[model samples]
Target: PVEIGGGDVGVGCDERGCNLVDHHRVGGLERVRAAVASVLDVEVTAATLLTPERWKSLAGSVGSVPVNLAGELVAASGDGTSVVRFPAGTAQVAASDVVDFFSFPGEVGGAGRIDRQRDWWKSWMSAVGSGKPDTNLPALDLDVIHLLGTVAGGRVRVPVGPWTGGEDVPTIDQGRLVDLVVAMFPVPIPQAPGLRPTVRLLNGTGDRSVDSAARQAVLRAGVELVVVGNYRSAGVIQTRVLHRDPADQPAAAALAAALGGGVLHDEFLSPVTDLTVVIGSDFRMDGQ
Candidate 1:
């Protein structure tokens, strides 16, 4: 079909309520509508779905792109079929192009969970950098991964490895770290515990206790455990360096040293989702 000469190509997750400054008319999508209408040779309306191909093609023309606070799209040329779409990745953008983008905290740069975050961390740890406790070693790429589920009362699953659903424990095969991140909304901690703090664990599927005597084992391990689970999916167990907590230590590092560079801290980050809106005006091909 036809293609626009210059535009922005940025990655975003949500596309329900985003901002578009300098790219389109503020609070007026007429410019965007007109641009798409001219390209499609159709009447402009407020309902459309620009496919990923279209966005990629538009972004390919530019050098760098803007994601506009993450997922965002809009309708232009009516029939609800012709619209705008945004994808996540390191794409192209124009020097003068303007695109809006945003992303959630738990989410990563691209898709699904923060798999990239995990990969990046593994790389960062090799060189090392300065962090809060400030060391000359490369900084660990610590980030949050969002699996589907509530942290209040429902059960959460996390896989303890680089992969999302797999386990990397040296001894335990197909092992999983399932825990309920019990919310302390109503009850706040009175005082920090001097000894290692312990939380309760249930089978998640049922209230049955698997490890009745199961304790976190180490007092303050270097590894941080996270539990992630969605409504329809099973829970997953994951373990990574406790970069966020200053006092906390990683349990895996000691294990990694003994394993001789075989330690598996996979540095994986979870992904998050969001809904954003495209704020701009219609456009005409002739205008550009």
Candidate 2:
């Protein structure tokens, strides 16, 4: 099973930090899936990264829009004849509510507005004075659920046991797997679109025999292998790098270099700590 830790929210578009915060590293199963698919030259699905500017733009759009009594979202065209109205009953929560959810305090310039919002919650009684809600809006637990969904999508095949995620455990069909990879990366494959993907196994069991065999598998598949840990049994090493735009050679090259160079796991890559190469049962998996 995969465990997706709550993503860290911080100010700025610094991709390295944002990536760490977004769980690019230690992102559990999501990271593993991306790495494996990237290596095989297969497509990855539902992989998306939103910049802070984009988040702000969404927030701005939400602010200008008004919520009607029925909580419907209505957008009017510049021309008098056009109007787009979203039905009220379609969503229990307003679009603005969703937008506001990403308006995290300290996410922009570290101003800490999101924390201020939390503080505001504590002061609700003072602000309301004697006035109480007509309907009970019981204590909501933030720990029980998250308001936003993950941005990456893909699947992983572990050789040993049955998968752990509930809805994620659809028997892996070739077509569905292909679709998922396509959706995640949404990019054209390299010289060979028909290329069967391969993965590098970092079984650093410290036995030359085991390492040699794994190396043979990689060479047989025509891929690179950089081993660490126990070459005999298991070890975690930089494995895969996904390519979004095959045409973007520089980007693709940089990604490859990063993976080969272990940039993602580099502690110096970001301030987020403990970017360790974890292996075995301790590792968690998350499906998009």
TM values, all candidates: 0.17, 0.22
Q: What's the TM for model 2? A: 0.22
Best by lDDT: 2
lDDT of each: 0.26, 0.32
Write down the worst ten-residue block by lDDT for model 2.
Answer: 144-153
Where model 1 places Cα greater than 4 Å from the true spot, the runs are 1-79, 82-84, 87-89, 92-110, 113-191, 195-288
Query: Could you tell me how far off, in angstroms, the CA of residue 243 lies in candidate 1 after the best superposition?
Result: 28
lDDT, residue 288, candidate 1: 26
| Stretches of candidate 2 exceeding 4 Å from the true structure | 1-23, 27-48, 51-53, 59-89, 92-96, 99-173, 179-187, 190-288
Best TM-score goes to which candidate?
A: 2
